[model samples]
Target chain A: MNEKKSSAGLKLCISDLSMSFGGVQALEGVSFEVEPGTIHAIIGPNGAGKTTLINCISGQFIPEGTMHFGERELTHVRAHNRIQMGIARTFQHVNVYSELSVLDNIMIGGHHRLKSNWIRQCLYWGPYGCSREEQMLQAEALELLERLEMRHLADSPAGELSYGQQKRLEVGRALLAHPKLLLLDEPMAGMAKQEKKQLSDWILDINREMNITIVMIEHDMTVVQTLSDQVVVLDFGRKIAEGPPQEVVKDKRVRKAYLGED
Target chain B: MEPNLTDKDAGTAAARPLLETRLERYGAVGLILALAVGSMLISSYHLSLLTTITIFAFSAMGLNLLSGNAGLISIAHAAFMGLGAFTAAWFAIDLGIPILIAIILAGIVSAGVGLLFGIPSLRLSGLYLILATFAAQIILYWFFEQALWLTKSPDGRFVGIPEVMGFEFGDPWHYYLLVLVFTIAGAVVYLNILRSGLGRSLEVIKERPIVSQMMGVNLQRTKLIAFTIGHFYAGVAGALYGWHLQFVATEAFDLMGSIELLVMIIIGGLGSLAGAVLGATFIVVVPELLDMAGRRLVDDMGLMAPIRMFIYGLLVVIFLIYEPHGLARTWRKLVRYFNKKLFKNKNEH
Candidate 1:
């Protein structure tokens, strides 16, 4: 495992990453670097271990690799602390606090970023209140909700919303964490065509407007081709192609691997 | 954000202030009426029994905070009660602190000790946490037994009755009113806390600890707070218990007593205050009723007195198997059924 250093605009860099689950190797010497302010997609067919690779980068697994985030080495960092260091992720299964209101759900994402102590929150008085800081977080969260067009459901419980709405809210939550690098795991897994289009546009808008680099695991080739600046194609836990989406999607190995050459 | 209000929230907000202000006034009138009726009709023995029932209700209310809302299956609650009782006794006997002050101090001390046990178990969860607290009970119980200088070595002696402003709480009726007042206050405070962030955090931790951790909820702090606060109530109950009993001992707060409290919460309902009261009432009253019937049956068939205990044990088993959610859910179902049936035409779409 070789640790790579990130330049000024580099978002995340991974080198010589290998992870094995018992007898099976999920990722074998996988390497990729995502530049800041771009959409980087990792796409693969069924059982290709695309998600497993993303999970490793997100610090869900202690893989045999070196991961660097904004000049900081993140290979040995825990999942929660990795999140704290501006690397936030959304789960594939649209995990949101169902009992909490949609706004509260997003606010929980901002909780880790909050610098106030428990005493300040408990007392809630002048000077220590840091009303400005709190308002800033709220403003940012509300703006994200408004941009996603889910602001109307802010007061409603997240559970009461439709599945598509829940996924959007989970993304909004990840965004609220103030991530420099957002790793989205199958954001368009189960959605109507219109919903998928809306989510795709939102993902692109977030990257362009917020200047947050996004590394996404997408199964939809059309979505990947449209939204991603560059695509990393993985098959059977190994990268088969890495280049611009047009070049990588048309590569013989990728075409055969994705479409069954046999 | 604008305070987005649902219909339920709007209705509750409108009704709550009125409910809050009027409840005590209405309750006072109702209580006065009930007292008049009871004093005129009921016997003195039954009145004494009612007093005991009220005190036990208070103790159960304390247990409800620990078991009901927090979802901690604590078997060391009775031990907490004993800690409170012994603390009160020692304070009154040694320092000559007034009973009210002693009770408050005892509660604080008990909460501190509960935190001491709870902190260690914060990292370890579920049955492991239970085992940790069970060890606390054993250690605390052993200390009470062996520490002859404080507890006078197991035989147990009577503590002085609390006399406030020359009014001795010698009668069961006097102590009953005092206990009921504290109990109501405790219940109200508990309810308020349940509606607050503290309560929400506990529910979050109970339902999904990993999610709460990810959301930056301090798991150790929350667990410690719950444990300490729960035992604080238990401690208060113990003071009232000791005052009511007029004695303190190892036998009063034993493992069986702790188990009985757990049974009360389990048989009542795990997560509701009403369930705790129901369970406690069932535990206290049902046995007496069984004993009365048992005496008659024994006279007729020459059965043993231990048959009542057997019956009680069997009822607990049956309750756990058939109605694990306890009588609270039964009451909820009844209410829902009535609402749907009687108010069908009135319900808005």
Candidate 2:
């Protein structure tokens, strides 16, 4: 919020974050800072706790450390309440409501933002009631779909879409929440080169235009190097290197952990 | 489905804005008129049949919202109905409340009970939730039989002639109108909920609970609300049933009755409102159909009963194996087919 390098979005601060599943440690003493409005990518090889780190930040897992989003501490926040504080996330795999229409799937993402409750929703026919709210949400969903180039698939069930489309649908769903901090787990997973290129462009557009800070777990080092402003390399649940993308990717520890190097 | 352009025609029927169209404006009025006209045209015996179907359909619609849409199964819905019926009886006989007011109040009482039972759903789901609700069915059924204060007797308590707004419902036709009004209201509410964000939240919670929670849907609150509303529907149906038979009994709210409600929603279609209505009608008519078939086809009474029962079991199997989605999906397919043909003809014209 200060003269902190074009920081219009929330500053995400994670310090000494550690988590374990019983005997197996998923993340350990991992720490990183995501500058506001910056595209911060968490990259690692298999079993490197990149997804775990994303989950911890999104309040899926309670890790041992401090996670501050702007002024508030999100260490003990419930998963449902996380989005209320402008923290929205996509799953590593497709976790969208596939049974619902693409538009409805996105509309449901903004459920917390909707003003109508049980009474208003049940009695939706009063003067300027839930019906009006529904129309507004519907329009917003359609617009988001249009942006995603999925306007034609608005009425189609999410299950009917291609794997790449489903991934994009998940992103669009997360976007509908209007989160200040967007956590994307493998946004380019199962995508073709062309699809990845398009998604990378879209990510940059979302960061610059929407002023949302993004923390993404990416397997593709090429994408990690190209798209991210900052990069954190994790090897076996520990942060190996963290800096600007170019600097971190060139680090000896990062190269040893990520690429096949001595 | 067409592989083509036309951004102007991007909207599908589902994509259309909820309740924004002129057709949807008069939707409630149209629904009431249909129910009223349908009831008026039926004879006494048919009126009784229609009323029974309507009452069951009303309850199944409630179950459908929970089991069908929310993906939460409850085998204790009949007990909810029983609770409502008994509560209505208490209001009418003990407190001297208006039957109409009593019915609504009875629903509220059932809803409260539903919320109590729905607590187990927070930690339990799928088979566990079913078992939990099954326990609810048994426990609530026992309460109905033993609670002398409500039931008045082990046999049953007879509900008096239901009077609403000075109009006594002594005639079967008069009572049928009351049930019709409630069923219409149920259908309307069911539709309204499905279109609204609240309904969509339950749906998301059903399909993807983690994602739903991450999206900020309070899982516990949503599930409880569903149970409360779903039980209210069951309760209203029970009250109507009580008034229809002039009796409220534990026998009617037993485990078998709960299974019957479950079958109604499953056979009709899980999530479809029409499925709830159709399933109720199917269940009500099937027994009458079996009896009629048995009498016409066989001479010996004992043999006829077994033969009819075998056929009934066979029919259920055939429906499940073939139409797993239920009657609503089949009905939708037929409607879609007819619409397509109609559109083709229109194009030619």
Span of 10 residues, lowest total lDDT, candidate 2 chain A = A1-10
Per-model TM-score versus the true fold: 0.74, 0.92
Q: What's model 2's TM-score?
A: 0.92
- What's the CA error at residue B168 for candidate 2, in Å? 0.8
Task: Name the best candidate (by TM-score).
Answer: 2
Off by over 4 Å in 1: A1-37, A45-88, A94-183, A192-195, A201-213, A233-244, A251-262, B1-70, B155-157, B164-167, B299-324, B330-349
Give the C-alpha miss distance for residue A261 in model 1, angstroms. Answer: 4.2
In Å, residue B240's CA in model 2 sits off its true spot by 1.0
Model 2: per-residue Cα lDDT over B16-71, one tens digit each? 33433333335436866776787778788888888889899999999999898998
Please, what are the lDDT tens digits per residue for candidate 2 over residues A199-223?
Answer: 9999988887787888999989889
- Pairs clashing within candidate 1: none
Place model 2 in a CAPRI quality band. acceptable
Which of the numbered candidates is closest to the native, going by highest DockQ? 2
Note the DockQ of each predicted structure.
Answer: 0.15, 0.42
